[model samples]
Target: MKDIRIGIIGFGTVGSGLAKTLYEQKDRLRQKTGANLTLARVADISITSLPKEYSDVVLSNDANDIFNDPEIDIVVELIGGMEPARTFMLTAIAKGKHVVTANKALLSIHGKEIFDAAVKNNVEVGYEASVGGGIPIIKALKEGLVANRINYIKGIMNGTANYILSQMTDRGLPFAEVLKKAQELGFAEADPTYDVEGIDTAHKLAILMTIAYGLDVRLDDINVEGISSIEPIDIEYARKFGYRIKLLAISRNHGDNIEARVHPTMVPENHMLASINGAFNGILINGDTVGDVLLYGAGAGMMPTGSAVAADVVDISRNILAGAINRVPALSYLPEHIGKPRITPMTDLVCPFYFRVTALDKPGVLSIITGIFGKHGISIRSMIQPGQDAGEPVHIVFRTHRAAEAAVKNAIKEIDALEICSAPTVKIRILNPE
Candidate 1:
């Protein structure tokens, strides 16, 4: 049997992790898969020095080298963006090479095109690393659990933001201070916008929903809310009421429509997801037969993610040797058989809420606030008035029953206009996930 040659693009972090893993575990991997996987080339933006082990393999910044090399059987893309990554993956497929990528953004934006190209080229594209780092959730959905109808998927996708929020709630640090510490620790990126602002989670959700519901949802269509405005005070109150604040990405099938939303949510403190702290990811999936199944692990890291990519490469090797007959479908179903699931608008999502209201401390202030909720057809399930903050103002907590987000938004607009309420309400949805 001949060795399977692999060319890795963007040899940093996960890229180098894959190279080192394949090099070190060559004999073991071959024994497990009956395939000899070899890292024949490496590409990246800047080069310092090769890791001595990959001395014979071609080392160049030019990605075209991988395509031109006849020995390179597979192109593994770990580059994280859309431009050159997407273009390069398509080109590799056109050259009749198999591709395995960890670029969720590229797939979320240009998946249809890339998958079409792979089908046309009669090659396979593996994206197991794109959804969950080491958690094989993509394979679970696309293979093992294919028979069940997935009713809902709720995930704690971003780890950096989760770490910050966990610290703020547990250690009582302010949001800004904790975020600064996260940046220094490298758990968070220098910019941190995508991670903290919910865009990164939304990108992963966009990919997950496509596989779960077979929906071609636009990124803009998913309701996204960041944890930027989250306050320690709100976290404290949520804890007092037996809930933990978590940035959750959720998608559910609501009859004919599927609802997808990413936001700071209040999960019951007793729930398993609430206990998932620091830089880790957990996904709770519900199906008709499987009921509730939970998947949790290190969401992002060099070797954990690299392990996933290596598994894909091995699977591709097997598929190629098997004549590509029994491989799992790319999107978990045949292309034409995938029905277009309708995405429910954000306003249509109905859920309970946790809102903090800062108001002028005075008599009948509660009445004025309750009046707005009444006017907008909203009802309050519980209330918390901690007291006045020195000479500043009064802070009150209101936990409401499930209500249409549109109604809640309308009531917020009215409350913000009132002289009793100082600003727009600080809102967070409550998820029981039954």
Candidate 2:
């Protein structure tokens, strides 16, 4: 019946947002949850000085202050990395403090260890804000859609990369130019490798895959391909063929093995996810009985992400007050009920392909390319010559039918080795979700 004392670690963007939201909506939260949420301690490296509201509440440069506090009920970790964050969360769990975090990278990589620690300590760990920002996709997977077997999940997870690629397609701007604009808008980090290189999306997908399918998939196991290699010309050609380029994170349970990959995919223009533009994130989940489900919302930001974190705080408060057992398992499924599946390798994945090749603008070149594809048993669904620049290289686009990824790679190697070809090939998976 007393207030739940909260401590926030790493008061950066999301942490500060949580603190401000707690103060701004205190009255409403108290009325709804029947328990007051109060921030008793805050930790961050950037603070030359702490906020005035927390003058009485302990403030520290070291995050251990939260773990050591006897009154703190929940320790929220917003620090976005493997180090210190992992150690801090573990320390909190060891101290019998409920752990909540928005750190996807840390969770994706070391989730098993963290979850085991929580279970050992008989505490709860909430990570609703980890995957889809404010979308609450994690809760949906854990609670709302708990009955259905998840067949597949596809999502646009990285806002910066999505924004850049979407802008490039719409405005016909070069990738570099669009990325520069995104950087200026504070949508991208100084080192955008994590976002642009598919690592960020891969991390989120790993967490989703584990929860949805109850599989333990490491980050290295996921086949990751970023959108940095996408040329503006590819986008134009894709549009000509009624497709849009998007960096998608896809996970599927394909009976034999699990397919988890993050890459720049050629999604059909009419598909619902294709219309998801700008910085918004959308997830399409295929359930056995529920059919297709779509969840879209603000993927990132101060208030949006903070709202998710706050919701978890309220849920924890209610459960603790009612003496209800933690109904939701840490990884969606109960620990003993977790399924073990092998991560299908890239070469084993079967999907349609969209490839671009630079070849000499001359007769018989197209025939030779098609000949090699046939030899490798790769059937071409369609082909296009997107015009030749004045004295520049000729661009050819090919839409190939579904085939083993190994065969596609072999075909591309054979085509690249042809005397008529000018450069390495560009291949993007074509996802035709009807």
Candidate 3:
């Protein structure tokens, strides 16, 4: 058995996990793959202290040690950023070593450049941990579903956002309260803009779309919306209508075009994804041959993500032993076959919408709102208006029939401008079970 030396940078959550797994399970991995996979070194700039178990392996405060070394055949970049991570991966690839990573944001933004460089250097990049933690969705899509054309993909990829939403729905708690609780519980970061604002989910979604279809999808191409605007009232209303609000990352194939967006979506109660709660993740994928497949697991944690990174190491090591470099292209497709996807504009999309409008109690207020919706080609399928005292502000919630995105925006703008309105309307897209 040939020895494949490994070097890891970033001793944070994921980096430490990878080191521990590779170190402790060295015998098991060698027996399984017949390759001596070695944890050659680990480098991190933020090591105040080190775990006693990891004391046997090497430790460095700088990343240059990994790049400068010649014996490291696989460079694992777990730093989770753009600048040095990108540069470090490129440097390792330039040295003709296989690269593995879990940095979704960096890969989503600079994937084209990195993959281009990998191709030029004749190396492979493993990113299975980038999307659904340890779910193995990337391998399933890349190899298992390679024969069929993908129809659509829906996933709850972010555990922090899911935890916040799950708390809000189950306990009827406000968004602010749950976010604070999540922060205390270590499920969320001090600065959670990435998780809460749908940016994190969008980054993962872009990577999935890129693999599912041989297209290079980016973060800016996705239409992202956050869970901050979701309120208790909206949650209650969705329950009454036999639905639940979830931050869903969705990508659909529309023949010549594709639909990619991330937002707080209204899912029917019976949908499989609606039942996925807490810091867990679930992905629903449909291929022409397989129909629908659901993958559910702990999206993020020490062992789960580390296990993913280790799996990539084994795969790359086996390939190295077999002399099969680039056996599977980094994005599961060659550069000649991968190109920019035709993303469908959000404005032209047609879907059901839930509107929460606040207006003064008056006879003509309903008429004015309905008139605007009608003029813009939007038809209301149902509405709920609880009794309100005369002249007081009343909340009228409407579930519209399938309407164009442009029509809904125009109608909401006109209705909010009305003199009798109390507050701006809140709109959320609804996805009925298909």
Candidate 4:
């Protein structure tokens, strides 16, 4: 069997996981792919964290050592971020070395440049582990669903945020408390802003949108809203309405325009996405020919994510054995075929909404709120006004029919400015997938 020399940069969680997979599954990979994979070198600042078995593998403090080595055929970059990883990958491509990475942020931001370099150098780039870990969603989109036109994609992409939200929903805990528990369980980073604020989900959505629609979408284009402001009362109200709240990354193609957003969404309790809890992930995709397909699995973890990276390695290995490069276009479409689709502004997008207003228990409060909704051309489908003690700020909740986001925002702003309203209105978009 032909031997494939591999080099890894970044010996962090994912990097160590990849090493473990390479060490334990080497024989199985050889049997499956007929390629003897060799872990030639690993580049990390501290080699102390790596297991002792990897001592035989070449270790270096600088990543340049791996890039400079001519024997290394595949460079797996697990060191996430926008800096040296981008430069290192470009250098590897320039040197005609294939790349496999799980860095979603780098790819979402600098994919076009990196893919261009790979094409220019006639090398393959595999990133199956970038999005849904161990779910094979990348391969499903690029290969399995190649024949169909993808209509839309919705997913619970961030495990950290999902875990927090799931805990809050299950235990009736608040966001802060659940977030602390998530951090204690290692589900969240010390600084969980990226995951909790929807940036990470947006990064993954950008990658998925590019592959699904062949659009040059960027993370900045996605409308992002986090679950930081989601209250236990809001969750309770959603449960009362037979729905569950999930942080969802959603994208829909409308031919001339596409909608991409990440936010806390209320989905029907029976929906497949609603059933997904804990740190697991589920993606629901719609296509012209396939109708709707759901892919569910462990979204992130050592073994699951490492298996995904190894799968990408095997894919590149097969391509190498066949003497083919750029076997599939990096974004699932030829560069020339990629068209710029206008991203529909969040203000113009139409969706049902859930509104919570805390207003002084005085006369005409409901009338004023309803009048503002009417002024904005918003139609309320249903409302709840639970009994409140005298002279207390009463909670009023309304579910609106399909309305433009701009109208809803304007109405909320006007209502919040009213004398009777105690706090800014809470708004959560309601998602009822067809």
TM, every model = 0.97, 0.97, 0.98, 0.98
Candidate 2 CA-lDDT value: 0.88
Worst 10 residues of 2 by lDDT: 386-395
Score residue 300 of candidate 1 by CA lDDT: 87
Candidate 1, residues 288-405, lDDT tens digits: the string is 9989889999898899899889989989998877777336778887777766658888888788988888888888888998988988888899998876745456888899888899
Clash counts per candidate, in order, are 0, 0, 0, 0
Where model 1 places Cα greater than 4 Å from the true spot, the runs are 389-392
Q: Which pairs of residues have clashing backbones in candidate 3?
A: none
lDDT of every model, 2 decimals: 0.87, 0.88, 0.91, 0.91
In candidate 2, which residue ranges exceed 4 Å CA deviation? 53-56, 387-392
Q: By descending TM-score, how would the candidates be arranged?
A: 4, 3, 1, 2
Estimate the lDDT of model 4: 0.91
23 Cα displacement, candidate 1 (Å): 1.7
Q: Which residues of candidate 4, in runs, are more than 4 Å off?
A: none
- In angstroms, the error of model 4 at 350 is 1.0
How do the residues 1-434 of candidate 2 rate in per-residue lDDT, one tens digit apiece?
58899999888889888988899898998898888889998888878666787576667888877788899999999988998889999999999999999989998888989998998988899999998889989988888888988999999998888999999999999988888889999999888999999999999999988888887767877888898888889999899889999999998888778988999998998899999999999999999989999999989999889999988888888887777636678787888877666888888877888889898888778888888888988899999986775445798889988878999989888888887778899998899544
**Which candidate do you rate higher for lDDT, 1 or 2?**
2
